[model samples]
Target: MPRPNVWRDSAETTRLWVFDALAGFPLILMLLHLRWWTFGVAVTCFVVFGVLERMGYSVRFALRRLRAIAGGSVKLGQPWWGKRQERL
Candidate 1:
């Protein structure tokens, strides 16, 4: 049998935000303590989220979907780095 859609089960809905915060808190702490590696830390966080979800979507894609359901200003397929000011 296929794995149940644990992510969508109503029982799991509340836990999702809880888990998100739990993961983010450590990253926030590290960012506050370390003044360097800002980009590296952010990329690490995105990878962590994608790994945690174990979904096929890219980190940005996953966040796009999550934001869509949660209501946010982000557009789909936008890179985790946000909009491009200039392409070289």
Candidate 2:
């Protein structure tokens, strides 16, 4: 049987994947409407956006962890470390 943690991880990964895909949809269409060289520039911008998004996700996850720790919820799932706590 799949663990609850596996499900959570899958959901988070899928959500991120969908978000990136949705955000890139318009850029992809615009690139298709432009010249091939312009598509290269679009690709570069897409890469930059992806990097920034990843960094932001990491920072937000860290902040959430810090807040949880401060609130005495250390026993909860550590989403940043991809660890799930066993129910006691």
List model 2 lDDT by residue over 4-86, tens digit each: 66555664433335345434654777666887776776677567656756777542454477698788945645575676667
Query: What is the lDDT, from 0 to 100, of the residue 73 in candidate 1?
Result: 75
Per-candidate local distance difference test: 0.61, 0.60
Which predicted model would earn the best lDDT? 1
Residue 15 deviation, candidate 1, in Å? 7.3
Model 1 pairs in collision = none
What TM-score would you give candidate 2 relative to the actual structure? 0.33
Where in model 1 is the C-alpha error above 4 Å?
Answer: 1-19, 55-88
With candidate 2 superimposed using the best TM-score fit, by how many Å does residue 9's alpha carbon deviate from the native?
A: 11
38, model 1: CA deviation in Å? 5.3
